[model samples]
Target: MKTKKVVVGALAAMLSLSVCSLAPAVAAGETVQISVGKVNAKAGETFSVDVSLADIPSTGIQCLDFAVTYDSKVLTIDKVEAGALVKNGADSKDASASLAPLFEGSVNSSEGWVSAAWSTSTDDASYWLKSDGVFCTITGKVASGVADGTVSDLKIVPINRETYSKSGVTNKEISCGYEKDGKPVKYATTLNNGSVTVGTIVTTTTQPPTNKIVRGDANCDGGVDMSDVVLIMQSLANPNKYGLDGSDSKHITAQGQANGDVDSDVKGITSNDALKIQKWLLKSISEL
Candidate 1:
């Protein structure tokens, strides 16, 4: 009898523990919902994506906060913003998600929402970057479910060039708009096309820019060197005599931004410049 009673007590305790284990644990205070308002843009154009949320609180409701991430390689954030969104096909903000205009917002928006403007690039002449901005609100309606879009990094870079590495292929994130925190959603849009071509006319006599024809970075190992001196010398023999409109050669620093006679401060072409260029060219002028 005693043994049976002990066994029964143990069974009861186990059953209680099991029941407690099966119960769902409540979530702590502060929930978040994020989604994609839209994701697409054309090079050199401005576009908008939407993000919505109902900020509610278990305790005394205060305010919510949100932000979108972006890539530096493909997009340059001009600013973050928030604004009152209007009904579809409408020109003003009325009743869905967007409420007020947040002309000044950032990836780190305070309170509830924000926006960011970024300079976008064309990977192949087809891409753009955009994002929803943070705006003012009259009420906090989240907790039930969150619905807001996020701005992110977009780039328009070459199809296959190293951004920071020689072997690392280069690609740009032109445009993108997604969400963070709450329930996830996607606005119908895509951005992975469009391009920007900054062209420069190299001397027809000189070979086009290749792994060999680089500026500023003459050594080819990715730095300034003597070989660069030779290239610069070859490019501009007597800036005055070369008839260098100065404008003919680009005052550029980016690869494609060049369209002018290269003027190195190294004075006249030096033998050291030749050595560096030869290293990158896999041959020397004497050998060629």
Candidate 2:
């Protein structure tokens, strides 16, 4: 019995040691660490940032609240990008500019990126250096707010210190990473992960006026009626205004990747409407 007990104790200790070694060392305190990946970049050009928790607590963080910090003398914030618009009753109106801090003001909102409730000290997570110790910080909240399909394209933008500017155009490539069960699990990059190059971003939105006008009203005489059928055939055949293969170019979006071929919905303004008109016209001719 004594021999068996000794063996069991030894096994338990070995297992514990193995587990400890497998865990990455998390330090104690609040800090912002950054990496530029293993590459060199030109001034006023784009670069990538590899983010992680730093000055970490050794209590073995179930979650770690962190923010990134970097020198802004070498870099500057450019612009803000967005995918969706918030409702009027929602939190904030869509603003296209970057953060503007007061003498001692800070801006880092957690809701802007990732599936997080992270709140920045200032309004948004943007920074430019007046004279810097740490100007740019990609604050991250270490909760599972991103696990339930809540946030999309959660990432950081870090332009090269040598190449960032405010007025002139510059682009930054941001990457994201995460830890699972207190260990490194997964992350993102520009390959399968997305990247936004901060060049010239132009948003073309045509607002609806008091009157909406479209020439071939796909319903009336020139609209969506029988004549529209003949118009569609003409469109398919002639397709070109002056001289072009207008029929060959169409933009269709089905969840994604437009499957528009020569006979399919190239741009969702489908030719099928023309087909419907053809059928209706044939029936009318027969009835007459």
Best lDDT among the predictions, by candidate number? 1
Per-residue CA lDDT of candidate 2, range 62-157, in tens?
A: 211122232333323232211111111112321211231111112333223221111112222222111111112222222222222222232334
**TM-score between candidate 2 and the true structure:** 0.18
Error of 1 at 212 (Å): 53
Q: How does residue 287 of candidate 2 score in lDDT?
A: 18
Candidate 1 lDDT over 63-110, as tens digits, reads 122234433323333443343321112213212114322122343223
Task: Name the lDDT of candidate 1.
Answer: 0.27
**What TM-score does candidate 1 get on C-alpha atoms?**
0.22
TM-score of every model? 0.22, 0.18
